[model samples]
Target: MVQLSLPLKWVALAVYFGTMSTSVLAFPQYQSLAGLSERELKEALPKLTPRLPTPPPRPEVYQGAKLVDDAAHPWRAPRAGDQRGPCPGLNTLANHGYLPRDGVASPAQIIAASMAGFNMDLQGASIATYVGHLLDGNLVTDLVSIGGKTPKTGPDPPGNGLVSGIRTHGTFEGDASITRGDDYFGDNFNFNQQLFDQLKDYMNRYGNGYYNLTVAREIRYQRIKQSIATNPTFELVGHRHFTAFGEAVFSTNMWVDGRVKGPLENHVTQEAAEAFFKNMRYPRGFFRASKPGSATNDQLQFVLGTDSSRPGHFPGKNVNGTNSFTIDHSQGSVADFCAFYTYFVGTRIKNLYPNPTGVLRRNLIINIEYFYGSRPPGIECTKVYPYGQL
Candidate 1:
């Protein structure tokens, strides 16, 4: 509301007029500097085009289902303590010469014996694939009985342990990458060495000095560490252990043809079979596909031979034999779930954990392993090995 003198008003008017004149000349001057005429300037500007988002590519589908072997492949020599002999579970079978007596109980030997029993061809197959089939396809049972005590109490609560400190038996195939950093397991819980020692003992006693379950377990654990360093999504939480602490995995069986004349025929029910695997636990190990072009890496699959060809599948011996195997908790003394947890899931990580700081992490891992073990098998077992007495 202040009044200004006439001279000041005239000065203000001159400034306003100068500014307008400059703005009007600005575009023309810019055009001149750019060496473009008005028409050219308009034409030089880029045309606006509507952009559309691109659709994501579909996931790769694996198709190789045929099993093949490579005759040129050389057999790997067994490590020390791989000599085969008698074990607690199958002394009767070994004494009878049903299973081979010379080979070590290592992964390769186990594959050879299992393939021979199943009538699968493994002449040229990669020994790795053979191990995968034997581990994934077979059902391990403990003929030992638990003295009226449950080994496991319940699923591990989240934030308490990685995957709830529980484990399942079988292989889960997927594109495992190291970049993921095994963060899928949440807290980092190193596998316990003491548990491995116990596993070694299991090998000496049950494996007859031929197979060292602990060594095999450690090898797989190392492989997983390497895999995590290389792959992006794959991370190992824990592995399946046959001997939950000192308790035996009891009765180990494979999915044989239900029609095959064997001692395991007509023993398992669909309900019980489903229930057992619903909470199945497995030890850690590296597995590869015998056949290529398939989802042979991460997804879990459980299989067995059944009595009849259920539907469209071929009428071969039931891969899911009705009574392929049983864990006669009633036979010998079996350990309870708590002991099983201690050895399989808890011990490996718990014992090796950095006390206090890793305690929660170890618990978390145990929980997660248990969670997966309680679920049905999702990955199908592929035949990639041959059968031979070990």
Candidate 2:
């Protein structure tokens, strides 16, 4: 080799030393820097960018349980053309004379017919005890004191007291002493007795003994209907529909019962009642307790009827206004006589039936009349002049 200048020699020494230092630090535990060639040193040294650590075999992302759709689940919306009108069951009953073919009947008439069919009695001796036990034992004492007059009782009894000599028929005709009956009576008597006991205990313990008279009447009829309306062939007469109605009625009664010791007392507001009614559901063709808050794809579209908001009406007044009635009533004084009868007769066709495809079926008309009132007046007749007009 030729002799090199001093500066060039120094530069070559520095380069050699720097390369050696890098190799020595690259892997301290393994080979020496002096043992490796330049190419080998370059291969052995650590990368400045660190080779990204081989990316740690990317972990898989976890997904939750997959959803599965089923028949009962995901509440399918109602379909188009699913809504219907008044049930056809009413016509069937009319043809059989179980109800009037004219489609006109009063609540009293309906009550009478149902009573006759079932052999129930409202005026029987047990009624006083039953009614008294519903509100208070004192009520029985008061009734007996006043010669069979319904006692002015409740959280706030009516000023006029009960219409004298009027009593409500229970669902069963059994003697209170009897424990059971042959068919529905066995269960029904127990059910009614339990209901009475529960109501009495509730009123005595938690409520003010004041019953909501109008609501009580409604409950009585509802209970009666529930007990009697169980003919499989009869559309309106089914356990399911009656059960639903009874539930609604019971709920309302409980609501009123709660108010007995609270702020509202027997004065359940119409707004409140309507709200409760709006939320009620029943079998097909029966009334929906309330207007549906929302619409679904399969919801039936039908008119309930005109909302009658008369201020001075009997039940309406009791619920919305200051007027209150005692448990007693002369038969003709109750305004809902026609409305109730018509509702029972008209809504008979809404019984639940099997669908061929097993899909949800729609009721024809919304049975709002039970909660509100009936339309077209259940019965209307004009006097005719046989000879000359008077």
Candidate 3:
């Protein structure tokens, strides 16, 4: 090669040395271009380490009374031994001398005596009309229709009798006849007469006059007791003694819708009645707000009539001067008029809101009445029963 200039030779030497030094420092065998250790390289590299997701928040805890879970209902199979008979409210009534003091008093006798204490008889004419409707064949026909079976002339098996239909009616309607009827029978008389006429017609069409009065009465008594024993209100009654507070709400002359008659026909609207019944749960804020020493205003227990009647607020239907069977307000002397009353009261009290604190709230009683043949406008009946009234 030709001889190189001085600067060119120096440049060639410098390039050769730079390349050698870079190779020695780079640590190529370790896959490190920066001459770093494994730990240093890892630290210098952009880290993509895996991580767990953040957890969600917890649910708020209720501080007031404990709720009765689905399994705690008294009527559920294998009922607790303490769950028999009327709730503790009945016993409390006996203890306070409002009812019979005899230890041997049956629930039926106690209920009868309680009705008598109000100057009302279970066999009064109003009650009798309701009883007649129950015994009438129309109720059975309605049940048979609902069951998709033809009405048979004779009774079938014991459990498959006309009572089965009544039970279905109670279940399908959420036992609303107990409370909503108060508005109808307590206020509307013409509607009540219309209901009675319909019942008579139903009886004439389907009644065979074969059902025994004594048997029917006993069945009614048992059914009423069972309804009371299994109600959520009855459970609340067990937790608190209401009589100590000297409070009670007596709702009179309630009625149910006639068979084949509902809201569409301007009779007790089936939809309205069902909606009212479905909403019979314990009042809102009852648990969290009803603790003893708390200033919460609670509801009073209800005693209402359970007779069938025409719709209280009928729309697009003419019910004036109609012969619908309403609570027989005419039968003033005999308790027959009052029989339906007892049933209604019994069922209503059976459905009180559950007591979260296992104690009754005090100073709350709401009596829904026609007072002057009409409910006072804008007044709402409280849903909670006083702790002690069963």
User: Would you estimate the TM-scores of all the predictions?
Assistant: 0.19, 0.18, 0.18
In model 2, the worst 10-residue window by lDDT is 355-364
Q: Report RMSD for candidate 2.
A: 36.0
Query: Which parts of model 1 have CA positions greater than 4 angstroms off?
Result: 1-74, 78-335, 342-348, 356-390
- Give the per-residue lDDT digits (tens) of candidate 2, residues 1-390: 789799999999999887776643433111111123345434433321211111111111221111111221222222332211111121122222333433223223322322222122222112222222211111111111111123333311222332221111121111111111212233311223454444444334433443333333333333333333331111112212222222322333222322134555433333333222222111222221121111111110111112223211112112222233122222111233333333322332222111101011111111112212221224442322111121
Predictions in order: lDDT? 0.25, 0.25, 0.23
**Maximum-TM-score candidate:** 1
- Which tens-of-lDDT digit does each residue in 167-216 have in candidate 1? 11112221111111222343122223443344445445544432222323
What RMSD does each model have against the real structure?
27.7, 36.0, 32.0
Off by over 4 Å in 3: 1-64, 70-155, 158-327, 330-390
